[model samples]
Target chain A: MDQTILDTLHDVIVVGSGCTGAMAAQTLLESGMKVLMLDGGMMDSKYKSLIPDTSYTDFRQKADDQYKILIGENLEGLNWGEVSTGAQLTPPRKFITDQVEIFLPLESNNFHPMESLALGGLGGAWGLGSCIYSPPELEKAGLNANKMHEAYRVVSDRIGISASNDDASPYTSGGFNYFLPELEIDSNAKSLYDKYKKKRNDLNRDGFFMGKPALALLTEDKGERKKCSYNDMDFYSDKDKSAYRPWITIEEMKTKYKNSFIYLGEKLVKEFSEENNFTTVTCIDMMDNSVKTYSCIKLVLASGVLGTARIVMRSVKSENVKFPILTNPYCYIPCIQPGMLGKSADQRRSDFAQLSLFHDPDKTNADVAMASIYSYHSLMLFRIIREAPLNFKDGRKMMRWLLPAMTIMGIHLPQQASEGKYLKMMKDENSPTGDKLFAEYSLNEEEKLSRKIREKKFLHAMRKLNCFAIKKIDPGFGSSIHYAGTLPFNDNEAEFTLNPSGRLNKFKNIFVADGSGFKYLPAKGLTFSLMANAHNVAKTVIEDARK
Target chain B: MNFAEENKYNSEAQILSNYLVGTQVDKKSLELYSGISKTTNHSMNESDLKIWNFLMKHPGFISSIDGALAFTNPKSSVRKKIFFMFAILECRPELSAKFMSSNFTGFYWVKFIWYGVHAVFTTIFGLFLLQWIKRF
Candidate 1:
């Protein structure tokens, strides 16, 4: 732990162990580079065994007891009801890091962006909705399509995606390889697919496209992870390693290249500085209140969009900078198939979003909207019932009876940067949590119009599938949980932009490997592309080191 | 009381009994009921008398049924009170059948059968598949 040994031991220092950071660290380790990864979160070893595997009825009986044991009494009052429907609820591990430190403007109150300081970052709570950027989408994001394909193949081979090239291929821009068989769709999803297949020609003419969504879930057992047991506990429990989490990669690095990789938990990196040929990183040890500095040949900041932006702004000693922040406008619409009402029990495995419906309404514009179909039982029915028009008591009774009949169609609309949408860094010198970050985002007139059009088109498609009683709930901004574009990459190295290789223009040794370096936030989920970009950046760092 | 008056009371009692069994009392209704009860000094109104009589007759079913409903309606005072009602009569199979028939459908029974068969096959075959993959 001495300074001399630390300086001699590690070549690259990576902040965060989420999807991007872990992939970067693994790639670097494989290329004979020693890495020191610092994370503010600690992994809970007893999580899997501690979670009970009982029937839902029995589980509900012990709900209070389980909550007390799992999340503790300290977080009993946390408003979980506020986040009704999203990818996943904040896990118990995020209790410490889920603090609301940002100051939101009046206009941005609905914009709630969740960040996780868990060992795997937000990837721990991710719905595993993995989609590769189409060639056009990649070009829009200012990335080389050929290089991205190479990176995508590398990522797909490691993560193992469950997908098949189908009708939605044109939208996904299919060419990349898939490693696992597509998951079997549930009866409800099968009904929708059958209808879509029957009316394929008509639907295609109406600009509607449907296919199985690419998911980062394993169909067969791989490594230490087991295949999905279809136990329907994906959102709350991690008992089955069938779903790919970033921790798996971190664990692989630790086991395979133990000598080359070292993970230091409970260390939150605040800022970094470049001196001569080495970068000095200052981090606070959360366990004890001590500040420590680590020096490395190169620094990679994959602490996520907001986390990385805070560190960069603090390093530059800036109070407020107009940085463009992008997010996909998200909404979930419920469609009821009355025939399927009160039919299926909630015990069966309801995978996240079995079918993805893609729509490109206009050929002139690159804008696209995607809707993923989810079974009713996949999410907590209590949350969905609250959105019902009935009173609380009546709603509960009705929801219980109608639970098996509902299907949620989640729509993600592509959002582009405008003059009003930007993040401002607050100057808080005395606080130990670093500077507070505030964002102000408003959709342009055109984007607002586009959203209305997309909703109408989606409802039409739902009606075509014999779904009735359609209700849409737009969760508003930041609910997408797909945030990017803080320190965007520019080929021209524009003011306050990262270079094409993810290295900052001013700092020679610093590299950003997360969504912060994205030039555009596409409608699809960002994790798959984030991992691919991280791999590309790691390769660039290795090649640069050789030079 | 006259025979006509007695017939009217019985008819009202029948309607209230159906309401107690079918409808879940929401928080707002419970609050209104509480206010009315306070103003009337807990004197049994026709509606209240019928509800109380129903609870007394189905004492064994009242607590469990009310308890489940009250848990889902935590904020309702009437539901909370009814949940702890004392039991005297044994729960009847006929009453249970009525509840099930009212709440469920033919589709539910068919789907449950399908799921049961599917679950059994997956459990057995999944284990075999894992073992075969491990051997490879």
Candidate 2:
């Protein structure tokens, strides 16, 4: 044990500065409760400085030093013909998982996990898809629907959302109060929308719903952040602040409540215990590898499922205990629009998904699968060229010939808790945290059949809309980057399970603020719902403390 | 890792670039490619130069060269190094427009037909060569 910092005892200490952690700190700070956030946040200073404030076309056409930013100083994103999680992440955004393995270690042969301890966690490179969860989805995820309804609006207002009320509204993008103007669809997506509109009735009868996406990207200028310039550099950088990163909120709260809120970075929290009427958090200062302790009235474990699970299990001295886990089964379908081929892509366009599609053949909306439609351009031509059957030189030419017509549709299906898929973390002396997590997830035959059947329906739906699905690549588990259900919410008290109010039933002042308690993982992007749940959890913590 | 090894890989990259572009080694484009390899901090495998020298003649074999190399030496894949070099060089401010314009060739319909036929032949040829090499 190193020195203990007995500074002014804080009221609330939130761990992790990602989407959920930021929201939890925001709600607590708003209510005048002083909050301190301990995080092992990382930022790619080398890559960050290299991000030039210019459009993709201009950079590709003018920047002589473009290779430094595109390929990375060390070929960090180098594709070795092996598709792993975080492989699609570009050079600039590589910091999201920069030192995650060294900081938070895990070993799994089947499950390839993508965990982020970056400043904004994994959400720094978020696609900005802001979908409001239905009441049924909230219930299934073990969240209070009534509470989430208000938190959804609160989260929507805090991090601005822009969505249009259209055909996919009832299932995907409706029921939110705070709104910005909808983003314009790209030409490739525009043609798909036109085709969808013509056959709306027949398509609706078949359970394929299409509409404009609800993205967190700003469509209109909001305060200091400018509206999206459509520079088509959504993946490379967010210098213009058009897209909302959770760090933006954390930064704002830092200034507004400077005295009340404190963000201590480089703190890898290990475990917590309720001692002497104070929740004491023991963490390792990664800077000097010194064990440090901080005491607060309440502690919020918002370091995501992987991080939070390790801490709770370690705190309780549990080892190799099987815990249920859930992740969205994901697939990427490359399709072609014959009409858009042999033409130049629009000079001003962003890589954000322009269209949203949901397929629920039974129309029950219970097991609905979702897909986001994006027009490919800025990721450059190397990826397609290597995958094509032709030689390198000819493949390059064939790709450019097929460039304008290409539309990549990433599909995701809802995940359920099964005996087959569970995670277990054990004590390890060699590990940095003295604990190692191992995940085992295998899709059952019925689950595989369900996914295949739903994907075929979605493929058919795309074909009807004039886009032909050429090939579908199943990127395997954890590719969707959606991890949840490790520490679930149950009404009864247990060692690892959490209560509805977000409390770890074994401890007094500890709350699992992130998606670890999500009993079910929705097919849609879970960032928005994670923020809402964190806000609701913070409020419940405040309420419980008052009582 | 050593100065000699770095220089050797850089020289090999220059040869691969010239062969792929089918043009005289433009010093500036070659320099750009060399600079990127240096920045990538990539240590070319001992087998890489040999593999590049071997594959330079078979342009149609570029697609299978990575699989073939991986079969022999798990670390020696020419796909990423060569394609990445080609990708950045093609994106050069001075040459991107020219290459892009070529893709929209006026006789694209003829080229599309040619691409299909060429693809079939390349697949057959590359697989045959890959199997032959894998035996060793």
Candidate 3:
């Protein structure tokens, strides 16, 4: 196992091929460093080959292994031992908040959950509702807004967004558009907007309704992509229109920087060491069980929260390496009516289907994203209906009861707070496996208040819009599916906090630009923030690496 | 009405309709048993047609029929309520054979004995097979 037998050392190695990894790879390569990326996802999306067929039948085909993870049909049969590329790989059981006890302080259980481990990361499954973190929220998160905003512009320029400039309605005003033209608003959407506009205008919250939320979709027919053809299908999967998947950006980077290499289908970095100012990463080739080492002048830990946490806690151990992770508290709001027969008649059912509500943070300085609430289509609706933990075998019973249901996702503030807390590994003689994931969490007081406020806002908005029979429920941790915080920054002077040139401090010639670096946000999806921060960090790495 | 003119009219209105309800169906789409033509009209035996007409037109007479033949016994791979009549038909022909046999003539008297025993069993067991007997 001599190091000389391994592949040639690259300038950097990136883990996790989701948003953060893809953005970091593109930026680093653009800055003239040979970059190597490793992801736990498959080599390509299931439907990547058939550009013309817009059906999701490919995902259901035997070739796709459709039940590979959460999106697959064989979820119940897969072993939990196979689930974790992250820190805590718990077995699937009933959704219980207080069952397993850990050393961390116990608290309320509230969280926002969203996760996917596909080639494009969550972008593959995201509703493509692209929005940047509001200025105030970024400032609260101790990030440079101007720099982050520039990064978002670069991302939008590369990925092509579509949005309308109209600001006359409550649900549509003041939002930025993508690179593409606005989607033709369907007839149902026009009617609903007209019906609700007068009421929305009277409420006077500066809120407006628009055709489709700004999306990172393609505008032209290029490379397995087609122009938006008014298909009205976004959530489950679209065959004709190409929603932005990060693999496309990564591919573009490969053509621009031929020297850079990105390897998919590899997992688990086996070892890392520094000698002669060069940090070497030896990762396990998960497919063949072979180990290979990669070297670079600088390394970027751009794997996301759960990913960064798993890698760090597995590699680094000590009482003092503790960092606070952030959890998003999320909820679903359903607006039902007595006469509603579960038919797809409303404009919201087909158009952009976006909804917006205001959020005030639960805690001071808590990083929160602008939590937008919108309806879920069939795929998501099926999952929500199946969430009752009812026996799946009772098909007839489910058919009778599961209809007439709709859901809207509400992101709570104190975006970083959660009832589930994290714990560091402790030394023990009787330990069978290595250091275990220790977490004890519950919703904090402020997060609960944020949920309450969102409930009130949804109720009020429903009444104003004449959307009747609205009811609210509390969604617990792990449901939001946005997990982070194993490696986080507390203040500006953390030794491990900033690498070098204002990156993670302790690791010279190393940078951490992923979601694991953030303490938390009150409300917002972290895509824009992740890209912007990666750009700023890559700039510092490129500037200082030469020196 | 010659053959060519008659064929041309059939081609224009080739939809298959339900024999009783007249629900129109695409002839090509319906999954039928082997040898069943997609374009052919729905058919039942003359005996079955008589039974079906009687049942539909006079619903009250159905409860009064003591031992009537079943109509339109469509055989399906899917196990359903139609199997009860099929099972009775498969089993009923055995009864007359037992009555005609020399040794089974004594079993005719055994039927009386068995009836007395079933009556006692029903009195004790609360007539558990009453629905089956009523169907028979």
Candidate 4:
């Protein structure tokens, strides 16, 4: 058959069904462009049909393949000789454990890595804790807080977040006013707030009060999405409320833009055309191994941190690329006090409720940069301990008694290091997972110290909160789930960046909106930030095209 | 109704299954079938004992010699596993209902089922015991 060519190539093709991708697709389609979205994984209709009364778990009985954990599992020792060498080339199906070998080398070998492979990517399974990047994070990206806030307002409005705060400024101006009725703080949490609020005031530090952060969950009726019934379970299966998963927006985007199309369970993109002004994408469908091709005037790669980085390294065979890379290292601390934790898996409190710890550069010493602290739900805490195979046998017993365990994630922005810190693409023969992932990364002396110092601080905080037990992680026991930066956007680097509009500098049609274009170090979970960045990039692409 | 009360009112078939599970009446048979001398790890928890006792005292007693022999067979792993799990239900049916009916009921029930299945699948004799239990 002659190569098929249509009169209208899509204005843009958004790759990956992650939050960033969905946001880009929604924004672009709403702007009157022909958009096509291609998810590298399957579709999740559980939350998709929430308001419409469709249940995601109508028939699910156990934690089967679909409910697998959201992390990569190299399983080197577990899968030796059972599978062929090529199997390691792809991501694992189960939520990855720390035992799996990572592609990146460590500085002193410290980092806890976790990433997912489902259609919505990490956002699908992430603790639905939505905190807009503090002002410092915006400045790190070379953008002011106002611009970032504008983009967040746009995103928050579409997703229908339910939140309230005494101090939400200019960012929440547009979208903040309207949302589901403010979630009522439970009496116990309220009492804890009163107890801590006075003590926090005494410390004179910005004491965070217990209130629901503006979440993309519905409390009022919306199309096909029922308002939340206060069932505070945030992670895993959200059988009730429609929280901020990308698939929800994608459904709306698909309806608004009739020209838009989506393909799920499709194979990963194997090749793409970025030669002239147009880009052609080619892939081998995993379902049947059949080759499929998609062409668009512009292509956006949003396959997330590791996935996007790997794709770029494989697709662009050119060695002449200019951009600095940063790897984020994380630490977890659990705080438990008698009676602080109530029943197990009860729907008494929201899991994603906590304030983020961001580094105030102005207040910090010159040597150290700012950092962001995040909280995890009890269920996630249980999963983290369960991942350690050593305690797998007694996980149930531990679950019975352990009170509030708080996980503090400290994102250490890796400084530039030539020795092994820079993320480089490498193909290896003997990866334990039987596949070859782009391997490159090593922490520097500063990062190594940063890891220890932050872990210690978090540990001390836990102790102050009356925690009984504490455990520090050693090197090789860590890996970051949120991977960002291998492709930094600099106006000067034509060969590396997509120029001013987030397009590949050389290829006018190819663009990237995910974490790939970010250069900020110690990046907080950049999902919302990247969505804003995509909004700006999409606006630029359309405006420039008109010119 | 409570598992005990429910077991009393339950049909003879379900009662026998519950009693067999609650008392672990087939412990000797399971020990013989597995051929492994184990004490603590393989032994039934308190919950399992409750289920076995319920099964033995169930409304429909296994009166026939054949039925009795089948129930006592040590080789039936699936049947044994099911009875063992049912035994747990008998012990703490009230707590189980409480867990399942709570606000986050869906998540807890899902977790309860998952842990239960994981334990059952790990045992070598579980599948056979389940088959036997289902047959009766």
Candidate 5:
């Protein structure tokens, strides 16, 4: 509506307001550069109006009562009970876009990706599991360790990470500073920690190291954000703003640098091209159905891996261009610790996985696997029961008795780019977004073997802690919600590769700050690394602009 | 009750039950359920009627039925789903009995036995492990 905001050609145009885009904008704004962020999704205000300031129990009760009318029947076999934390349905904030087009090879079975076109992108519904890659892991992923360390510290300071230097330090490579106190471990998690402490030598020999997981959630009040209420509502609601969301940074940038930073919502960018030393981005404004063009001196593509890839593929006009994608192979194993059964469910605490188990059996190879521990109460029992081979009724009864004693371990295994696993873009005239993105991903034989070995080690560790792993369910691929490597950054520039600073090889002024530039994806959560990488790239952009 | 009235009530109850269980229902049934809620002023949508019928059939749910229906609302979709989930919770006893008594063929019987043995062994092992660790 403001003519002045659109009239001026911005110095930098950052697309997507996710973790990377927001961080990139923050760094550039601090350097006194005007930045305009364009997003396809708008924030939904209903979430705040509906469940404002309600306790965890009341929220759950309210949600359960209204779920039938709100969500209707589980038409797509989605267990509505698990809607809070599960990746089956798009959360309210991310309900703006339709499911991205995906075509899987017949041989590639059970790979379902969870993508979001929300204002903050996938970070809006993230688990807040934040972990930095170790030096060796970073090197294996084709990134410089020295630069990454500085970037990690800068990003960590901006978005608070709560973690302690514990036994897992050897595996996690503990050198970075944190902003908040570590969250308290639950009774079941505490038991596992004690067992790890007592049997440290044995577990170490077996390549299993356990400790408190670092989280993006705040434990103390910082700026406008309050401390975590420990209400176990991290999955469903963000009432407290304690758990860090990238939109918080975007909001801050809007207020602190109102004149310099501008956010254009509901604008789906189609493609971009460079002409006369200026980059021109063509986008469709979903609100008014208007095709608009914006030109900038520098353009940064942080619209996530799939989104950035789609834009690049469309711009390059190549259907045969194949970019390798790496996703963490994910599985959920439910373990029962009878001692923790029948505990009071009313206790308030952070429900996100409080502990992480890291295993690097063959330390020589860059193969790493992590298992995050979540209490049974955090998940809906019906979903777990539905996984059983028994009839629904029997499964429900079993779940009722077993849920109290159960703690789920979300296992993540490292995956690399393979011939069978890559993303392809196809031109679809019928698609409202102009292009359809097809991702074909399948675990190779070697990766499958590796997963079995890693899973065995996880189960063995659980047994040593006196907990039995009753059942293991692989929710298939892409459920890990960590997608990367469509346009990998390489030292030697290639057709689909970017330079170390995330500048696409062919285009000098175009840059990529999202997971699209990752060559290799480790088993750890990718949000923290994405933020650091974006911050690092912002510095390069600022330097380049000055020159 | 007259046969016509009894038939109408049964048909409405069936529609409500089917809708709650995720079965496709006609718009006529939806409108009928809405009309009934309006007349009775009970906040009883399709989901609530399903729950009410289940409660009447199984008196065992009487204890927790009030808590289940406390948040029922005809206008709110979220409240409707929650009410149905509560109904499922209250009817768990009957549901479990039905599952236990269901007929099974040869391979199904084998599967049932296998799961039964596995469940028993795990429960015993879990209890024993808990007590042993408690001693530490």
Candidate 6:
């Protein structure tokens, strides 16, 4: 970074380049407030070009020097240990968690989270599911519902969402505008959806609503982006820019608001201090391993929930302070769709969530659980066959026969603040980040029993759709990556709390623009709400600055 | 790997792929597959080596050995090597379309039923042949 730029007082400083931080910077720059974004912004230098800009099926057919893309130089994902949550993440997506433990270290006996310092952070590898939080859900999260709904419209328009007004809209889509047509799904999803339609009334009465969920995928060509080609490579690469990533918005803001928007990549933000009505943000530039400081009138911490908690606790000069950590407990059940049995895999399709099933007992918002269903294939049969209870050759043939009828139902349960589940920042001299976050997360018997009961109900519902659940694969704790509830916005002037307007209660000029302010982590996807809250927080900062 | 280790891995991966895909794998493919597994620390144990030696002499015993161990322990070293070989072969386009086939034909059940019958017959035959070969 330039010394002169650091010496000059920036109008606003945004801490991350993730989904929330990008929206915050965009809102601030659109309002003509000069903004500076400091991010790690690490990108994949090796496999991005090795991957051809063709459909996943085409790549499999052509095999254009594909040794590096699937299996990395060091065999990045093929491991002998227990399977991690994102083990299916292709080699090209390694940058998402490339140096996360080094830059943002965390220690937990049970919880294993996936944090990203990549160019677009975790949003770079998002599944493109966009579940809008309802008004009641927003209220539980201590956010203004009307303002959030309006911001949802703004962000929805900015990133063209693809969805249809179907039965699942009441639970998935929160009445957002400007959506493209739904993308085409595969044979398994179509079979399950047709089965659900036949048993719609009974299923609805049993509290299961299944339909096409909202996705951040382009159905048709948009500005500088093309429509989804049904390549089934959403897990690997975004060749046609069909899926909306946070970096796309950041790139747009860089060109559109060149004078107002300034992004400094390869810089990880550390703790900040408020002095003389200006916040001095300290960062470690990864390029030269040098400590740099920049002063800003207003600072927005959108560096994820745990990232924000690390800075806040460290800034307060507390070596140890526990903050509540909430994450949607996740499990993936590979169900067998009987209707699609003995049917060939679709030639052209998407691997993203083809159908979303919401388990809302009252059909309202309270105590709801969501399941995003995906069709199998394109991730390769080896990952699935490895778990089969047959011989390798028999397992291979069995998976080849079963892949066409498989539907992976990834269910996420709503989480709340529990005493045993909290994250604390402690000093670590050995770590490069200067501090390490220790998270203690475990489910109590009551919580576990309730989740099992709900999951059993979901299994029953799946049976109604003619999908048989063989067994459940617990990917592990905090793997959903929808971490939240740390430093939630409250009225009191607590050290680890924020005001309703996103201003830090203990500090005057600092604010949070991420899930750190969320009081309740709803079962729905939180990316759309995170972006909306960041936009609303930026607008609130502008409003407060005028005062 | 040295010359011995490299040759051993190539020959083993070849036999595994031959059994899984019903075809032989090239040297380059074998080299790449074994190169990736070097970091995995999945080399065979004593019993796994015992089974490996038996399969080396009687390649048809792979089905029986793996099928018997499938229910008891699927993560055996020999089983893992077979999976590793299958994974490398799946990367190729030679038989991927066939591997991805659902057998969506009028006689789909016939092939599926025949596969089940072959599985039972091979397992019974291998159980006797392996132990009988070990005695000799």
User: Mind listing the fnat for each candidate?
Assistant: 0.03, 0.31, 0.00, 0.00, 0.00, 0.54
lDDT of 4 by residue, A1-547 (tens): 1143233466777777778888887777777777766665654433333222222222122222211221111111121111121221212222222212342222222333444445666666554545566565555554446766788778767776666654231222223564555555443344334444445443224322222345566667767776765544344345554667776666666566655554444456655777576777776555565677777877888776655655566577655332344555544443444434434423445545433333322332122222233333323222343222221222332334332333333333333323453444444555321233434455667767876665555444334434433444332322435555566666775555545457666666677777666556433445666777777777766775677
As for candidate 1, its clashing pairs are none
What DockQ does model 3 achieve? 0.01
TM-score for chain B of all predictions:
0.24, 0.62, 0.21, 0.20, 0.26, 0.84
What CA RMSD would you report for each candidate? 13.3, 3.2, 17.6, 12.1, 10.6, 2.1
Best-fitting candidate, scored by TM-score: 6
Q: Local error of candidate 2 at B47, Å? A: 10
Better of 1 and 3 by TM-score: 1
What local lDDT does model 5 show for residue A276? 70
Candidate 2 docking classification: acceptable
Off by over 4 Å in 5: A1-6, A58-110, A362-366, A389-398, B1-136
The lDDT-based order of candidates, best leading, equals: 6, 2, 5, 1, 4, 3
Return the TM-score for candidate 2, rounded to 2 decimals: 0.92
Give per-residue lDDT, candidate 4, residue B38. Answer: 22
Q: How accurate is candidate 6 locally (lDDT)?
A: 0.83
lDDT for predicted candidate 5 compared with the true structure: 0.68
Candidate 5 C-alpha lDDT tens digits along A439-484: 6887778877978887888898888888888777776777788888
Tell me which of candidates 1 and 2 scores higher on TM-score.
Answer: 2
User: What is the alpha-carbon RMSD of candidate 4 to the true structure?
Assistant: 12.1
TM-score of each: 0.78, 0.92, 0.63, 0.65, 0.79, 0.96
Candidate 3: residue A272 Cα off by (Å): 3.1
lDDT to native, each model: 0.67, 0.79, 0.46, 0.47, 0.68, 0.83
Candidate 5 chain B least-lDDT 10 residues: B94-103
Instruction: Please tell me which model should have the higher TM-score, number 1 or number 5.
Output: 5
In model 2, what lDDT does residue A153 have? 88
